[model samples]
Target: MSLEAQYLANKLAKGFVGTNQIESNSRLCMASAGTGYKLSLGADGPPGSYRDFEKADVFFVIGSNTADCHPILFLRMMDRVKAGAKLIVVDPRRTATAEKADLYLQIKPGTDLALLNGLLHLLHENGHTDPDFIAAHTEGWEAMPGFLAEYPPATVAEITGIPEAGIREAASLIGRAGEWMSLWTMGLNQSTHGTWNTNALVNLHLATGAICRSGSGPFSLTGQPNAMGGREMGYMGPGLPGQRSVLVDEERAFVEELWELPPDTLRKDGVGQGAVEMFQKMADGAIKACWIICTNPVASVANRGTVIEGLEAADFVVTQDVFAETETNTYADVVLPGAMWTETEGVLINSERNLTLASPATDPPGEALADWQIIARVACAMGYEKGFSYESAEDVFEEIKRAWNPKTGWDLRGVTYERLRAGSVQWPAAREEGPDRNPIRYVDRDGELSFPRASGRAVFYARPHIPAAEMPDDDFPFVLNTGRLQHQWHTLTKTGKVARLNKLNPGPFVELHPQDARELGIVDGDAVEVASRRGRAVLPAVVTDRVRPGCCFAPFHWNDLFGDCLSINAVTSDAVDPVSFQPELKVCAVGLAKVSSPRRPCPSPSSRLRSSTCTDH
Candidate 1:
């Protein structure tokens, strides 16, 4: 172990915080916290079961290449496609998954809300809405029509660059389909209006009554394997394990009891900060101590410079990872060595709510320990020995399942570790029915289904077409959309270690339309400097016809590897959606300039010969 790792281990042994084991008999205990219908857990009201992905029939994928990011479960989507499911892909560039899609809507960056609202308007006008479902299950339906009235196809076409006919066609496909799903990834979440983008998609699903059933839902594909699991365990701000929010008194009491702590001793009512707020706090010095487990915020979060600044400014920072060297760990006061995915025993909840286990295929590297073990030891030191005690991951899983079980409907009374050991089992697996778990939930044999609402109906949230947080203009002429490459993962933390993977695509490059490249005198393999109000980076230009004019695409995976170049996020805005707080990394205004020479004494005869010359002319 490195000196930093030893320091963290020593601290944990001294007892700073208590670790509590979470067990579950019903795999449903692992559901994500937000964007789902609210449910009651007998004595406590936990957040509702999320159905956005699980219930989708016709899935509209905008800005996400799930095939590359979440490869394992993405096969389920491929199966659905082969079964003749309708897939709509909206991205500036045609990606691998887009090649297999039934329809690919190549839209400009930052225009998602306009395109989504246009579809909703068309759905409303075409008489495709389920009035019965709206009247029974929803509260905000009446406000939706009024809100959508402003986003006509022509107006949306002008903003999004998608033809009116395409908008109408997409609406027709979604409205006529038996069930529809809308799935998005960082493309939608990393934008200034990311939360609004998520809310807008949910609005469409609810309006059409397409949620909470088989093959119909609005799902947000998580970037990390344990992103969903983290939420379930209340690792995020303002959440408790089992979908319980921190705001509720009873919910807080339940966790307090689970931890065997007095209500007065535990923090009762502080609002949990999101990623953005957390970093902001770090930068401003309000949050002096931060322990980052598993995630690398510096490389992954938007504005790499600012994220690093925040980390450096922190009074104390702790990072737990298997790797000795990481971008985030470089700034840590102490680093704890934790097991890698293949070297740990834990559960991961995928986009489809499918629970899978990662068993220890190999022993951890030198001095490295399982994440739970480290956390449990810390908890013991913090004086929470009763809750932190755990002999195995199975013990944690068992307790989490019991917490999720109620005496009544849809409880997980039947599932056991023995069954899980047999194979990966979907949630809601009752003990009595050996392996007959509910693969496709909320649907009746007759093909009709009811939403999981008090009235058994799905309500459409009337979401208006809000403008993007940032708009392209003369100063920043191109819309810069940031995303991942085919082989690379987020921030290049682990994936960067593999030589073969790095060889496929070595460094970051700006993907541009042929016309834009020609107009800017940007040749393929030519280095170009992309700049925004926030920051800038010089990268190679990959001219292709895949992207439309007036926009450019860049990957978010490069840092330190290539000239300490600024990350695309450095130029991305921090404007967030009101609901989800997801940043708008999908859309931002930027300008590109080709780098002519390594060292230039004076301007050359060719206008393009000057590295700093503006390419607009």
Candidate 2:
């Protein structure tokens, strides 16, 4: 079905002239990291693997709360830490992960680039770089020193709110490590300067020759299962199957040849609209119809008012999901029930590039079908019979092998469904290379260095630090941030229904500093109305020092389904990075006021988006 979705998207793009609008939900989460990886390392997947974590001498975790978000990986990291590996954490909030850090820099939000550049500057100053590696394996190194000089410790400390001594100590720790690994997620990716934030981190690794090795590399941890596979399958708007881009003629030709299509079967224009732009176009009536699969955009997207408007304004909307009562289904003209986890058989590729096949243990209820089945059925209904005629999941998997371009060093031809059913396998499973699948990337089994770039060398990007799209003013004095809780998953479609999980994390609340709460004349559990330039939401205030004084935090799990106007996306900024188009959901300016009861009624589903007001009951 994954192959069918890609096939149908390509066909639809070919049929529709002058517009290509196929996109994936990863745009909201990992697009910045993807763009950054391609820009600096010449490809998207991590150069190092999870095996590196065990052998690492130092671990640098930024932007992610790994303890709660990725518990199993956190356990592995802790195991390494127990064996004498130093752990460094950088975040705006002093999270549970930070609590265990050997060195924790609780820096200000959205200032990752500044802090990273400062560390790189210090690394160079302290003579920690591998000049030999840079000359041999990397390119564009001569231009970085001058740009890095702009981020001295003093300036970075001021920008990030971490002390100068702390900054220097962090650099020294990273510089002295025998082998270090960096881990990050949406905290760095969901910002206006997200791409540069990633670029700077890669810059550090390249400077120290910390990548393409056993115990060191810059690893972007994905929050979702199969997100890496989705990218490999070309789910991004501008992509074709096997990470090929429509913008590149040779890559397009390869896919066209594999699919047995004509020379110009795929669209040749620019990359298609990202999620933010896609909804904006739908709201503008440029996109007449949309088919959303396995995602709830209304609850998850920043500037969700626009998403709501987009759904309401579109000529037709189809939502294929496992749950019937999703916030997105209210606006969907056609609701297709998709099979749940154990009810469907498919393959999932996890963060470490491990491919695992899941066999169905139970049948789907009612008329529900697998996601791919739904796509193939729709394609056949639309008269694309021959292309969509795949007999089984194994047949689609076979075509996926053909879709891979060997030149990219991501050969999947050796992988068979039979092999996958027995046990999991990491990718770059070349037909010629026998059973051993190397977890590490960018190098051959012979340990030869070869980047997939045009120059066959990893490139260094001279990127600059930029502030968040919206800064706090008197009207909106506090910086509002959103993230996940330990117990609940995204928007709580599944976990919210679990009684134990609900008991662990009962409901959503606004987390502010005790100082801020005192200043606002509020107490713990007080109903506080937080209003941003975009929209507003009211929740109980949890007064603590988990977050910095000038900043506040909220979990984005609750939505209208749980209560009236509980969606925290209402208060998030829609500003996106120009390069990656990933929204800065991590930072926005919002004001807080104590409320007695619900001051305003929750906005109706059919309400105009410009109103920008929401409520909780």
Candidate 3:
């Protein structure tokens, strides 16, 4: 963690005079995973690393469209598939990832918990569960089987819309597999039942001793590259570095002494705002000055119209990012030019917990600065001079090492800047271990059980299924799902500038089932307007069979800054999971309309775009 952020988190939490809050974009993408991981195993990062991908015989890739978002990791999975590993993809859309699956369970949206419980029911019925392991290394495992009784194949099939036979077949594949590695992303995390979705997936591993094995565990593929690092460094609310929480007295005391601050620097009586709630506080005039860095939340946050209104309502708003022309900067009171990825040097921790040092390939443009440097300057300006004087990125690295204390079990003392610059290494590699030593978690395979939980054992959550916060009705007759395109990165701040990339997906478009399109009198190039109770988006429509009949897909990458088109989040619902507070961005109800514009339809990037380039599925 940066000293500036740590100090402020402490101050703000303590309700120190003149301080209000410190929030981040971390809550939007990984909050549910974070909450579930901590609840299940009593920590942030997952027990399994990417190395498990190489040793596994069965890969359950659910919720995530790995082929689009984490293309490199998906390539590795494909290598395993070719080597005879069976792949199972669970999703509502026939995504690129699902197309490669040995079994694609086209589940009903928001019914993942039911499907997972149904798997456990089958596992128990077939006597595939590992009672010895559960008895020895787990708490609450005895109770899970009883809960699974309510969700038999027939019952789950009714809710999930997957055939009962398909459910049984999937259960058999997962049950009898040599090793299992389960993965998911936004599709599971961005929903009202996100935490439950995650815990339910984890339940499978706990039920059958599928975790902590050489190639077995539940893995949440990070949407953002350094999301794991951000969590480890206490970027979220109620957090301190080393996976410590402010709510814990011992952890709070450790942080207080680590920074040599007054005992009251961090508040005791209140919790800070998350991303979704922060905007609510802003609109209600409870917060004054708001600062956003790195993320383009204006175009990305669920309910785009409301978030922009909150930004506008702030007394003072600051946006620090690479682009000067972003929709966010349009409303900013001050713009701090942040250096782009190619123009900055720092460490990025990927989904697997590997610490990778990214070196700048070119100098930053005029007046722009690295993210950390900008933060340091701002801290000094705010009169925190002593700790804010960082000479280089390595200075921050040294501080991070200090913050990664032994007690945290994420001891990174061996991972020096010099060693990291040469290669990456996973966390928990202590100084006694070599600098290059990589680590996997939870040593249960050798009959030695270790969970990060206070009980010294993993906990199985009997979480129940909950429907999506918003569902389609007569007024809003289709479910609107928003996500990424293969060639276009989030918001397209950098990729949109590429001519070749533009030739792939030229503008904003919504993908609906051809049956729904035909029923609504829409065509491939028809201009359409999709509306929700919150807002509306106008874009070109793509009639495809990839999405289910009542569900539609829209790429969340385009906006006025990129193609002078609509942002999908405008029509996305802001309803959030009560536990994670992450908006239900993946599923919402919207009505689609065919626009009768007098102007000619924009030319398709090429005829093959409908086939080759539309990776939205």
Clash statistics: count for each candidate: 36, 1, 6
Model 1 residue 585 CA deviation in Å: 11
lDDT of 2 by residue, 1-617 (tens): 34344444554454333346777767778877888888888778788788998899999999999999999899999999999999999988888899999999998887888999999999999999999999998998999999889999999999989999999998998899999999998888877777777888999999999988999999999977677888777776777777778888898788777766778777777565578777888889988999888888888877677788888899999999999998899899999998876887788887777878878999999999888788777877877777678788777778778876665677778888888877888888876345645778877769888888877789888878776666766666678777888999998998999999999999999888887777777777677777765567777878889999888888899987887657786221122323222222222223334254456656755554545643221
lDDT of every predicted structure (CA atoms): 0.59, 0.79, 0.72
lDDT by residue for model 1 over 1-617, one digit each (tens)? 11112222222322123221111111111122133233211211111233333434576888687677666546777777667778888887778877878888888677788888898899899999878766755666778888889899999999888887888889989999997767766666555555556667777766777665556666666665545544445543445545564566776676566655566433434443345555666778876777777666655654444566677778998888877766677778899998876787766664344566667799998888887788777767777677667787767666666545232123334656566566665555556465534555454458555444555544444445555655666777776766677788767777788999989978788887888777777777876767655445667788887777877778878765334443654222222212222222122213333254422222221221212222332
Cα-lDDT of candidate 2: 0.79
Predicted candidate 3 versus true structure: per-residue lDDT over 263-374, tens digit per residue: 7565544466566666767877888778788777777776555566678788999888888888777778999887876777777777777888777899999999887888
What TM-score would each prediction reach against the true structure?
Answer: 0.81, 0.94, 0.90
Using lDDT as the measure, the top candidate is 2
Question: Which candidate achieves the best TM-score against the true structure?
Answer: 2
For all the candidates, what are their Cα RMSDs to the real structure?
7.4, 3.1, 5.9
Model 1 TM-score relative to the real fold: 0.81
